[model samples]
Target: MIFFIILGAVFAAVFLLTLFFSMPAFQKNAPASSLGKLSFFDTKGKKHHPNPTFVERIVLPIFRKFLSIFRKFLPRNLVESVSKRLELAGIQDNVKVDVFLGIKFFMPFVFLLALFFISIFFKVPTTLKMILILLVPVSYIFPDYYLKSKTAKRQEGIRKSLPNALDLLTISVEAGLGFDMALYKVAENIKGTLGEEFKRVIKEMEIGLSRKEALRNLTKRTDVTDLNTFILSIIQADIFGISIGKVLRIQAGEMRIKRRQAAEEKGMKAPVKLVFPTILFLLPALMIIVVGPAILSIMDILKVMGQ
Candidate 1:
């Protein structure tokens, strides 16, 4: 009776808290900022777009409130770290640290509540109980792991695409286009991570940021060693009044060589990586196929002799 009463009180408190937070008093009103006007109606007063999805209509509002609630609790250092990770992951603008933290804190509560219900309604094993406990930390740490994975993949894409982008920039610059024009051409020609980053750099330049600062920010956001070297070379060229074409050609050559070396290194490791699958999966399958028929034939002969 006491346990039920306590559980009911906890649920009531949670429900009340969720309601309070979801109210307008706790939520900030921010005007939408977009490049163009967002109109929901057409000329005939018809809808121009589909209705919002479940997440957009319901989850986001709740999440915004939760975000506001959790925003104040983050430590300064942790916020900085989250900001850096989000920048590297290419989701800095889309997902703020407070929103991410709110999700992180909320998931464990959800997991706990779900487990509590399962424990009440059914028999939960000791292993499941252990897993329920483990889910708490996993809920918190999963975001970091996900963010790191995204950053790694984005960096790899940027690294692989850099040489090609540099080559294009070199070609355009040598053909008499100015540095900025050549950068524009490269961004327009390539359709990958490198292209998108270059487009961002261009936008930054347009927004009154100096070229050197924009390039530095590009390197910082990418966190790729090859790109950092390329940007450093450009910055040096700018400082020394060296010919942009000459600097681009040199950087492109170095990037091509580095890319080739990376390819060769991966080629060398391929056979070593294949060895594990051969022993664990292929070798066993071959042995089973060869030995099985012979064992079956021997068993048949033994049965016939016994008959």
Candidate 2:
């Protein structure tokens, strides 16, 4: 009887959710012609508009509501910090601060709901209960960790690509293009995090910011020491009437050397990193293969001697 009640509840929930999303209030203001088309997820294409799935229609309203409610409770400084971190992660183009905070708030409740349903099906041990309790806080903080990881990956990509970008910029400048023109050329040629940042700097410059100010903002956004030092060199060169090509050429050489050294350092540490895994996994498997037969033979001989 309880099983039937729970099953009915699930069906009713689904029906109500479907009805809620299908209502006129949740429908997009897009024209009728743009509606009823199939859309799929694409990494390089715009998603979630002009062709939203039923799930999106259902979830987006709740997501927006959560965002609006949570936005009021978030402090101004926290919002700004999160916005900056998201920008550093390259996701600010896609997700806003309010949406991010909404997810941060929403994920914990989702985790709790999942835990509740799971506990209903199976008996949760004390340890599992404690873990489920701990998961709420972990889920709440997961957005920040995800942002940090993305930022780290982006920074690493920029670090690897910066030298090549600088080299391209150097060549462009040496080829008689001005610094701004060189930036445009590099943005056109490169296709990674560094290229995107250069494009942003160019936009800032176009919006009335001085080259030095735009470059400084780039360093601030990236928080990369090598890039910051390179920016400092460019700023100093621009101030002291030094040649741009000379500065870029020197910075490129230094960045290339640093990248090589970093690669070599990581390679050198590979064996050290393998040590614990070798002892824990490979050694045990080897021992089982080599010693298993010997143990079995000894047991058989001992039984015979006893008889």
Candidate 1 local lDDT, 45-123, one digit each (tens):
5334478666558866776776866776778787777778777766544345666666566767766775677678766
Q: List model 2 lDDT by residue over 1-307, tens digit each.
A: 4344335534543443454334332233211111112122212454446877765677656766767777878798988888788666654322356666766766567557656765777655668567667868986776678678768887898888888899999999999999999999998898777776787777667667999999998887788899899999999999999998999999999989998999999999999999999999999999999999999999999999999
All candidates: TM-score: 0.78, 0.74
Candidate maximizing TM-score? 1
| Each model's Cα RMSD | 7.4, 8.2
